[model samples]
Target chain A: MVVRGCENRSVNALVVEKQKSRENLFLIGVPCEGILDWHKIVSEVGEAVTAVKEDGQNLMVETRDGYQLLERADFLHDSCKRCIHPNPMSADILIGEPLPEGDPNLARTTVENFETQTIEDRYAWFQKEAERCIRCYACRQACPMCYCEECFVDHIEPRWTESGATPAGMQGWHIVRAFHQTGRCTSCGACERACPMDIKMTYLTEKLNHDMRDKYNFEAGLDAQSQPPFAAVTLDDKNRFTVRGE
Target chain B: MNHILEKHTLQDLLQSWRQDYDVYLPQKMENFSHFMPLTETSVLVDGDPHNTRIPPKALFLPMNEALVKFTRFGGYEDAKHEIQSRIVFGIRPCDAQAVQLLDTSFIQEDNIDPLWSERREKTITIGLGCHEPCQTGFCTTVGYGPFDRADLDAMLTDLGETYLVETFSEAGEGCFLGLPVASEEIYNQALDIQRSAHDQMPVAFETENLKGKLEQNFKSDYWDTVSQSCLGCGVCTFLCPTCFCFDIVDETQRRERVRNWDSCMFRTYSLEASGHNPRPSRVERTRQRLSHKYVYWLDQVNQIGCTGCGRCVRYCPVGLDIRAMLRQAQTLPFEVSHAA
Candidate 1:
């Protein structure tokens, strides 16, 4: 299995989880060069790219009229830029020379950048992003960690979220889905890539990942032996469930 | 009605038209031109007419449309009561013809779709003739051209500094108020531009024999091999201009009967309540898509379902090219029909 490191928490968790029962799992890791933001390319080209060829670090696109060149660095998904681990942390067979570590401050800068905005601005941004969601569950389907046979969104008995393409429904679906990933989200950028509508949904997961790292001192899928911080709790774990005054 | 509008004059016209109509122009956003509502800051990039990633089909048939709204207390109510009269400016010729094909699929039938027809009636399509057809589009082969003008009320041909406008319907005639008539030189230049655009579009394949080829090869293994790489995503059918299939889903709590766009590629599209699915696998769904577009569409609507916008070709996560499949389909040995 070619483990797309750091961003592939869902797959990593699954593989690690499987290791408890299954023994013969071999992992071949490849250093990720960051996934291309195809939607960015589509938007830049001003038309659907009929033909695409990658020449080194450049993407050559053929539209109806002519060719357009896009630098790969300019069109990488935001998660890829924030990804700290490109090479697999624990792989039996590692492919190619391990690349240098990504900027340590990338995740903090991204989180802080979004954090600097006012609550109203943040809400407005969320609403704007959520409104574009068609609720096709492309993000959910794209997620490797979202392996729930009966996703809460699909539960008609309790009905966690109403099945509508409205803004409120979209927001509910996204927030709930993103929350489900919590510590497990490896920031793989697959959900963003899989989305046909090109909704930038990784921001939700990335924020959660930042919080997990900050509060719990946990980064998911780094070690197979250790249990997920969220799953394994001790007396020392922070009990913030009570009201502040109480 | 037949006047040359200077390229700069278009901004003024659009500004004025924005007052009366929710004018949609192909505005360049991050990567592509989308038919978005005209804002004060909107700038038109007329160099490549094929710039818009998504077709203008959303003007009539929206991606997710609610058909009937029902509440526990208030039975059922019309979902889309307030239909806005809008103008879609700078839509490509292929997409324009695709809209006409949608009219055939939805409105021209005996039992016309109320929502589709209502929207179609209110919408005014001002087609901008493609100077150079998109490489993926084979509209010329599929009974249309860059400047075919199948059902466009108005057509604009780019003639360097000015646009040669021609009105085909009353709506087109009503769009202009004080524009001067085009000179003979301008008209000839428009004609030459049209001729060159038509010639520029390289036909990928001949569609004349496609229907026959598909009809004979229903059991062909080509579908299985082609669909092997398919992710079974709805990108193709959802983006297709003429695809009008919808799933009428009832929101129990809200009691609203919503008609969301459904794709045949999905397993649930053909699934029955009894747990039996007609299209159980990707192979069958892929075959159905090919047959529906290339074979059944001709029989039902007398037009190919695909306008060759190539959105499916470009957008498919798995890179499934219909043109390549069509080319492959052409080579398959014709199977003997039982009726024959």
Candidate 2:
């Protein structure tokens, strides 16, 4: 594998994971500004938007009518909005300035905003978003972590969820798909980018990543030597699975 | 017959049509405008005609449709299908052309798709001619234009405060009853506007020898470069005005056999039950998608599948431009390994 352009933490994680056995992997990282939020761009300027040019802070969108300007921060995707590692953690050669750090509490505030919402409101939001899902599995195909040959949603005979367009079926698919990436997801936003329906599924994975970090004090793909917290057997691990006082 | 109707009378005209046909016009949605059923609060986007974010094809071939129903003990039964008498207004010329392309495939001899044919027969298309083309649109290059009337029942051209209506069929002529007839001068002006609209559209490519160019580069390494950035997602296919691939599955729980929109981008799309796959990687899948538009459809239907609506270009997440791909393929040097 040869990575030649813009630095991404997901690419770093992938390299670290594969470099364990594959000695031929080479990574040449460059500084990344951020990935554009296409949904936000078209929404702000309407579907007739022509050329979208970006510098660092703003986007200039051209249309038949005229050109319109938009703030980059306001339109950035949730993952990109809170991205802390614009430079790869480990690289053989780096090309740009190290740069100032971003807001450390951005992820915390995002999770808190969702947490503050009432349970009913959250459920309603989840259901409404999930209802838009067409079971295309584009999200699954885009995510680097979703490599299972037989995803539970595709299993027959003892099917986890009946395959159809029903609301319940969509909910089952989203919930199960997100749960599978709980500790492994790198907050790469590829799944959300790939979704044609623009379903806001990153919230589920983000929330799960937060819980994993807070409970286990572990982060995924940050280091080459560290095993995934769930996969590792450690004496210091907490016993949350046991019955109370048993 | 040709007539001119004032902009203010549109509400009354739509109300009259509502009594007979389910009238749908371009209505602004969250991020884009699409043809939605005209309601009390419906408003056209400043009375401007442009391509909708979702193609008007949804009305004929829905995202999810039931083809057949089944019971465990009993055999299968045809799904209860209702054909609605409908009129879709403000359909852009490219989308209207896309419907004609679909007709060649679905309403063909010996293999007619009953549901699609029924809906198509009952639907009347009112095409809105674009005076100024959208940025991504390249309809003129693909043998259609902003003012093309090949597939429209009635064609409307914006003439300042009025819409110049030209009827091509009896069904279309019925719409101009009791309306002011367009003067010869006004008709002449409409013609000039259409000519300028055609001139204004940026020509993307000439398809005179597109099939030959594609055939020569079937096994080129160029596909590897194009497919690498692709996420293998269905956004391009789903938003496209002409893509018509579908998958039929037995939804046993619903007691129905449902047809859903499927993409060639998916790995499972070409997967075989015996663990053998022909289009195993994105390279082959990407080539198939492009070839289907530029090569195979011509062999099957006598017309290219792409209408140049440019929905795929604007909506692609990774910014994999199909226009760029086709242009690059024509010029890119490659060796022919084998026949494809």
lDDT of each prediction vs. the true structure?
0.76, 0.79
lDDT of 2 at B184: 97
- Output the lDDT of residue B46, model 1: 60
How do the residues B1-340 of candidate 1 rate in per-residue lDDT, one tens digit apiece? 5778899889989888888888888887544567789989888876864637666777777765677888557677877568888888888777887888878768764789887898788888888888766757777767678887868889898888988998889988788667899988889889998999889878787665778888877887778899898766677887777776777667666667776677787676787878788899989999999899898888887778887777787667666889889888888766446324
Residue A241's lDDT in candidate 2? 64
* Model 1 lDDT per residue over A63-83, tens place: 757899888888888788778
Per-prediction TM-score to the true structure, in the order listed: 0.87, 0.89
Task: Report how far off residue B175 is in candidate 2 (Å).
Answer: 3.6
Best by lDDT: 2
- DockQ, cand. 2: 0.40
lDDT of 2 at B106: 89
TM-score of chain B of each: 0.93, 0.95
- Each model's Cα RMSD: 3.6, 3.5
